[model samples]
Target: MELPKGLAGVVVDQTKVSSTKNAVLTYAGYPIKELKDAPFEEVVFLLWHTRLPSADELSEFRKRLVSEMVLPEKTVQLITRITYEPQHPMSILRTTVSLLGTTNDVKRDDPPRILAKLLTAIAAIIRIRDGQPIKHAQKGWGVVENFIYLFSGQRPTPERVAMFNTVMVLHADHEFNASTFTARVVASTQADYYSCLTAAVCALKGPLHGGANERVFKMLETIRDTGQDPVQYVKDQMASGHKIMGFGHRIYKNGDPRAVILREVARKIAHETDNDSYFVLQEQIKDYMFKATHLHPNVDYYTALIYHCFDLDKQTFTMMFAACRTAGWLAHIVEQQAEGCLIRPSSEYVGETNRHYPSR
Candidate 1:
């Protein structure tokens, strides 16, 4: 039998959490565009339950999530040490997620608490690395508001919060993406949530997956700082055999729907933050890329600019991706556990199959 390399276009299993069917993303049967403007908590609830939450249920769910955002004292202490290790933020995050499983009562934690802690832990990693004191989640603020405040150490305007809410919702899940599939593989073994999340983080650390956004920003910075023409820089890089970081995607041949939404957000925030030059450069590069290669930007394209507008360091960009994606990871973990099947698959051995034993 012939098998596709890397399991490309293979349907290994079924999931109810999300889908990329027809190149449109949906979470639990709701199209992403319809849910884009919904509260992040409502989307999270819907992903977990496969149904929208009632108003009262959403309120409680939001409150519960915010309340659980605090880390245990020991975890905070450990994170401080981990953050200052001069490692990549994603590396620090990989260790930190594993640390969470150790420092907390992993066996007793559920999805809501785990998701909340993941958010808080990610925010804390940013602050600690910057030598800023960690901020506590405010009691009455919603999850997005509190998450922004925790990392940024200031209250965000409603418009900014709304933009980020869309970011979180858009990233919440992509059915059987690399990291989510890694998470599900671990979950199929009935590992705890943190273990599944840790494996997912490792998968996402790869450049072909969640790490693309940081590289995208790095490319922007190189072009901006060096006074190189953006178009010329891309041309030179392509000539040198370097892959452009943020263009094209496997699933969305025409364009990424999330990129379309985030392009607007990136434009608004770029103008607001006086980063319009980068935005303009992006548009030029985007247009030129499409004309030259018919390749369109994916979700990471505008998100790099959006994070820069938020005053985040480029290295921390993928960690932000991990934070948004933790909700989806938890949702998938739960779903895989419910199905209770081992995810082991057989591989075809073609390497000197019958000759190896003779010499030994």
Candidate 2:
């Protein structure tokens, strides 16, 4: 049998968390367009349990997630010590997740608590690296609101919260993406949640995956700061045989559904934050890329602008991706562990397998 490179179109396992069927993203059978406006906690609950929660259940779930957002004091100390300038945020995050497993009461931990702690820990990494004090999650506010406050050190307006909540909901899951699949493979062995999450973080650090957004922003900054025409920049880069970071995806031939939703959020937030120039440049490049290459923008394209509007450093962008994705990772980990099967697969021998060594 012939197999495609990188297991393209291969079905290794099954999952119900999310799907990009026909290039339309859905979480638990609900279309992404419908869920895009739902509360982030509601969407997370859906991904985990495969159904929407009732009003009272959502309220209680929000409270529980917010309540668990506080990191243990020891974890905070370790984070402060390791979050110096040299280390990448994703590196800090990988070690921190591993530390959470070892330093906390991890034996009784569930998805909600693990998700809450990860959000808090990611925020703490941002703050500590910036020399700002870590902010606590507010009890009354929802997860997205408190998460923004925790990292930015300011409570955002309700409108801002709504925009960010949509961002989180869109990013919460996608069926068996690289990082999610990595988590599942680890979880197939019944490994601990943090171990699974740590492996997922490592996979997301590659430039082709979660790191693409940062490179997208870097391209925008290059065009704006160098005063190069956006189209010319694209031409020159393509001439040099460099792949534009955010133009296409393996699954979405026409366009990414999430990018279609996030474009409006990027526009609104960019204008509100007085970062409209960057968004304008993005539009120019986006139009030229499509006309030049017939490629549509993927989710990473606009999300780079959104993160820039939020005043995040480009280096920490993938860590933010990891934060939203941890929900799906935890869900898959739970599912794979419950299934209780190892994911070992047979490989075809392509080397000189018939040769025998006479002496060594």
Candidate 3:
């Protein structure tokens, strides 16, 4: 395919980004194989900074991340208002982000302290809105640690905490996806960064974006209630011309590397949690998918089962994904700022061009 205008392949943005090779590469350019066995916390430091941190560096970073988890009082009130009632997670996230423009330092994006607060703001809003009592970072822990603690309401177990960290690291950045593109477009206009982020979040709310995972849960529920076997469910849905929620991808000709990584996590979590239902259902779907359409699982596919294994509510799956993805969003934003170009795109106008109004 011919590269479109705007350096369609020029790569002006140097943000922490990756490609799908069925091979993993983090924003920091670290190999995925090396990270696969490393602690998730370690990988996060790698992404935020170019090199791995020393033990002391890790300790200090943890302290900062933990402290950052505390949301502002006004933000708390905003989240409390929406999450208090039954609401869509993506709507709550995007709207709160738009409202966040009131508190951002868009013009002063260069200040380190100001930028830290912005990162904290996004993470805190998601946690606070989820009915999770937010926790500020401890004297020593950094942004990620504070998030894990606030999210789970207690100090996370070493292993589970690592899982959380790895997830954030893995999701830290992807190259110019829909939401990232939205954020970049808004930022190009010198508008509020939060406005860009809010636009991105709204884009993510679409079923084709982050919302598909929630739909997967609904699919499972429907199948269970209808007492249909997995094979039968796939057959009926396909016959009716329905696409499975968690299979196939535009980029992954072989498979999503993230899906493979997450699938292993799901297996470990499933075995540990002793939830037979998730894996049992997963197997059924996998079989049915292969038999019916040759479609295999994607990241969101296993994520639904994994969250259920974590005993998380179906409503908040997207928010959890958002939490991890916030890192990626920031990475892209900073990269766009470095490029310093307005992200204006031209449209082919087909309306009447030279027509003049009748002289009265």
User: Model 3, 1-360: lDDT tens per residue?
Assistant: 455654434454445555443434555676664566565445556655657899988776655555444445776677667664556766777676665566444454432333345445545554665556565656655455555555555676667766665665566556676777777777777665676677777877778778778888878878777787877887788789888888886656566777788778877888889866767777789877877677777778878877776556777778777766665666566667667789775566769899889999
TM-score of every model? 0.98, 0.98, 0.82
How accurate locally is residue 347 in candidate 2, as Cα lDDT from 0 to 100? 93
**Candidate 1 residue-wise lDDT, 1-360, digit = tens:** 989878878999998999999999999999999999899999999999999999999999999999999999999999998777569999999999999999988777999999999999999999999899999999989999999999999999999999999999999999999999999999999998989999999999988899999999999888999999999999998899987888988889999999999999999999999999999989989998998889999999999999999999999999999999998999999999999999999888877755545665
Q: What is candidate 2's lDDT per residue for 208-292, written digit by digit as tens?
A: 8998999999999988999999999999999999989988888888999999999999999999999999989989988998999
- How far is 109's C-alpha from truth in model 3 (Å)? 7.0
Per-residue lDDT, model 1, residue 81, is: 84
Cα lDDT of all candidates, in order? 0.93, 0.92, 0.66
Which candidate number has the best lDDT? 1
**RMSD (Å) of each candidate, 1 decimal:** 1.2, 1.0, 3.8
Would you give me the overall lDDT of model 3? Answer: 0.66
- TM accuracy, model 1: 0.98
